[model samples]
Target: MNTQTYMQKLELLAERSISSYSYIHSLLEELKPLLPFAGACCTNIDPYRLLSTGAVVAHNMESIHHQLLTYAYGQEGVHSYDNMTPSHTSVMTLHCATEGQPEQSSRYQDILQPAGFGDELRAALLYKGSCWGYLTLFRKQDQSLFSEQECQWMVEIAPIIAKHLRQFSLAIPFVNEVKLRSPEILMLSQQLELLSSNSDTHHWLDVLRQHEGITTSALPRSILTVASMALTDDTIFDQRLHTDCCSSSLPCSPIQVCVPVREHDYIDITAYALYSHTSSIQLMIAIQSASPLDILPWMMEDYHLSEREKQIVDQVIEGLSTRKIADILHLSPCAVEEHLQSIFAKTKTTSRRELIARLLSQTDCIISR
Candidate 1:
């Protein structure tokens, strides 16, 4: 792609949300110039819930491979997944499998060859230092491996793509079809829908709106700003304090957050920071409120943390010191430390501060905005 077109497409990936089918298609179409390929697949990861969502835009394909590749980051022995590390965007060729000789590998013989694709380029959608989503582009059997220039370009744009996806995930619930209480509300609601609608989520939302006349509209600008603050809260605060110690004037973009709006207990909003080259805009997506008081127990189910470990992390988020947490839980300081260590291992945090920030950011959206 020409420099102008390349930058323009990358901008599109940043502006668009990923909840709709067309959104996924547009993402692939935009990237075609960089690595002209036969097809593409996207994986959206929700680290909070340990969930991964897959969307594919391929013709005459089976579902198993798509399902497998969607969660490839978490799965074992997936070179394509491992290649797209935070430091680099990688082009993985099936003809040159990392597992062994290409002809001996099952993935190459069964999947890549059958699909007539030889090369796979993965650009992991990362946010907050986690692989939240993945975009994989494929080439025809006779196609050459992706060039290093393409890899550099892909890595450079990965952050922007991830930022948009985070917004898309946050915006999904906000654009739900709400009952139009007035003409003004109706007009803005439709605009919100057009601006940030997800295909499957919007379909289900439309059904609910038809079933029950519940009035919904875009969040006010004031609340959107608050939700954005509440959503990011301490996470961004810490990032700036630690990462931007020297570059004090360079402000970070306001990333999206999911949170509950005030007074209206039934409404939940996903606040997004729409970043541009020159400036950024705060957007709010509203949905029904159903946030739990404590998410530790629920997260334990996903992370498989023992009850004792969950209790320790719970106390950590409550701002209790390790000794205080130990006394409260009737455990020795050493025992508390052990559980904290385990919690850190399972949740992938290095320190108490990081742990609390991670968990709180995940649930703060529901607590208040």
Candidate 2:
């Protein structure tokens, strides 16, 4: 193929590498005809495992020969050239791992030699900062040894195979671990859905407190923050009122809930300064065993969002006004206002300026055991 055509094919194959194992297997199959080798196989070493094999075109070799190659390479003890005994049949594996290139031996000298095999070339597969696996090729007596050009070609494609193997390792776990029918997360999701529609503030507070209790019971260390307004009408709010309630024992923090106004695309704000939703209008629950915000950095890194949205949120704790934000971002006043509206609704905040203050001040006291 032409250089440009080959590069284009490589690019397409790289994209397909991010997909499923079956797709990857198909890709390797397509690339096989271009090589001098009789067959190819890919293996993964992490967690010490072998992936699927690609289509191979072996000459006068039974499928058992290929199976034997896999068995020898797949074992934990067969990692290096020095460790392997110099057996004629298994010399290909040791040569590949040690030489960092394909190696060949006479079929007569190796077990395959007795079987009328003329030459064998083994290629080591390296990936993700470690040796992944190997691919072996065999030829009959009339066929020549693997040419230098063919070896170079195999080396060129080895890293691509490695890259795809690493990607496959990551993609598979994500697919397998996803909950296709998670009743618990689904039930919680359903409750959140109900909460999106419920307008009765008192009823919502009751449900919120019950939910908090249930969630907290499962945690080893838990802290709950409810809206101050929810507790203002209750006798418990006044009875427990003390200097320590907002400081020494129960630290007061504000939470803002921005509900979309019915008529326009604007949001209405509800601010709560208490941690317990049992008697509060808004609440922020902080499960104290781990910091939820610590997980945010990783989540943000994996997902894509507009630069403007990221900048606005990053500076939220700084208490910048929409006008000031507009000037800083070089955006129009109306555009800044629109961005702020989306931010408030998504974060369930009433005002952009108070977002940080509320997050810091809102604390749930964890009485140590």
Candidate 3:
């Protein structure tokens, strides 16, 4: 194995110099010479549903990618990750494997083997001691199994991977230009309108496959599948402020997504209802940035801002004027100004633009234990 090469790559990743598109795909290829895995996948899972919303999978296995989007998670209660621990496991050979048998499971027979993988190793991506993401490597059957020292090597690098990944996923960057004019209305504007109005899960899936891209009239099938997997039916029809109104506050906005095939690229997707249709929900994609408002709650708690102050901060980031914020929140203009002053002081920012820059420039991601 090339230890020197591995260390150099690790150092680069730690510096966050790796482009978003190559985050996992490029890293895995470098590690493969040492570990000798023919296939790999890196994933970001939603803690609530334990579903992978975004993933980077081996490009050669395009069909396998499809299965990944629809495949029921079989690793649950099967790996140390099920308990949200930082550990690595060889699906069939690990000593602590308590599940019936990894190789005998549906995931192996239906998904792994069909993709030409004979054995699988899952490495945990834990943050603050809980599994938030994962890295999986696959080897052909003719290859020898992974050794203990290699597994140890994986364990040693887990923290570095987790830290940078967290930064990458939550980054909205310190953009000189922060546009809030509302994302452009693309070809799916009509479908987005329909979904926003009703948010029927079935219709949402169909609409995903039909999104117009920069050049093409519709997105690629694989991209659509990735979007489908990321935008869960439940998350789409989430809690509504009113039955007739659009989706209420997302737990977090601009969901973090990893498109592995696209150079391990990361994108943040936010849904909005356009025009006059309150229920027509359309997805707005930020190619490599998080939504500025998504980072506000974390700042609010850190700076000890009150709920009213937090609301004002959110509106300010949304580019609303003091008068507009007051109107929307039903607070008097004087009260809104008072809250803004308190927020500015607490956040140590002199103006609305500075507040957004401070928050978006560097806010930690949430990773519950």
Candidate 4:
């Protein structure tokens, strides 16, 4: 098939009503003809933090995730996915980025070369001014390098993939009756190995696996992504201090990620460093269903609410009257009413009650101890 026809097929594929996993998995497979690669890593990124939230791997690339992430956030490596901007070229091959000298890339020297891989092409999946995920395709050592034409093709199709990823981010998954109200705590080694977890942890993990359609024994990609961020943050701290162990009483700062998992349901995952007396650093991860407050900002973003609209919506959710909200924001009651109407139009709700219900669906499932 011609390149233009392949591009059209990809656009059509993105429009299909499939789960996120299916869409991305099939996307990688379909790219083999136009952009041949022996391995690939496609990961959903937390748009705000620009950190990975989940990933899909092929050709045994799963084992290198920790190291790959390390180099991504490490001092070395150009064209890091996190550093990508809207103005920057979002798609580029290592050979091109390094001026045809791939040896100059730390990631190539440390991760790719060791894995017997050559010429990596990376793309930041962006749409609507927000990055939804990242794509990295790898060729074997004996394979030819990625050409400029191939990289340009990736740039053209990236937004389509990003749009699908964004749609999937807001799409509701199969709702399971079983729910864990309290947060489940998990301990992990610095390498992100699952060390232990609360009794309820496995139940929640099962739910995640079911939703992601992953049947493997490996730790869920979301959990690892969170853990990796925690480590990356600590690593940054350690760099300034010139020490591996944090001398302070407090553990490293934590990272909290909230992602939609099921119908009107979101999961909040919190990860932080745990320093034992032995000076060994472990990662502590807490997983629980997102509270109303936790999901509010995400809903606002999803609705594409303006700053004023977001403030008004926040007050509305807080059960404030129009006059009260107007007084607080120093806006006339008429202006506040007008903003409410706009919000209603955007959110597709008629009344304040309906708006709140739509913005903050009853996703919590709390049980008495």
Q: How far out, in Å, is residue 191 in model 3?
A: 16
Q: Model 4 over residues 1-369: C-alpha lDDT tens digits?
A: 766787678777777746677788888888887688999989877676676667788778878866786677544547576556555578988888888888898888888899999888889988867888899999999999988888887888888888888778766644456555778998898777888976588877877776566787677778777777677774546643654444443467788887667552678888888664445578888998777777676677677878889899989988999899999999999999999999999887999999888876765232111
Over the stretch 189-263, how does candidate 2's per-residue lDDT look in tens digits? Answer: 111111222234333333333422223222110011012222332433553454343442232433222211111
lDDT of the structure predicted as candidate 1: 0.50
Ranking by TM-score: 4, 3, 1, 2
Cα RMSDs, all models:
18.7, 21.8, 11.0, 5.0
- The count of residue-pair clashes in candidate 1 stands at 5
Instruction: Please rank every candidate by lDDT, starting with the best.
Output: 4, 3, 1, 2
Model-by-model lDDT, in order? 0.50, 0.38, 0.51, 0.77
**Tens-digit lDDT track of model 1 for 1-369:** 565576667566555633433456666776676568776766555434222323443533434343344234222354555555545443344434454355554565667767677666667677545555667777777887766677777766666667655555444233223422221111112122234445544543443332222234322322323333433445444544465334423333433222222222223323333322332332334443434333333345345567678777778877899889988989999998888888888877899888777665533332211
Highest TM-score model number: 4
Clashing pairs in 1: 174-285, 174-286, 179-214, 258-365, 259-365
lDDT at 354, model 1: 80
How many collisions per candidate? Answer: 5, 16, 10, 0
With candidate 3 superimposed using the best TM-score fit, by how many Å does residue 337's alpha carbon deviate from the native? Answer: 24
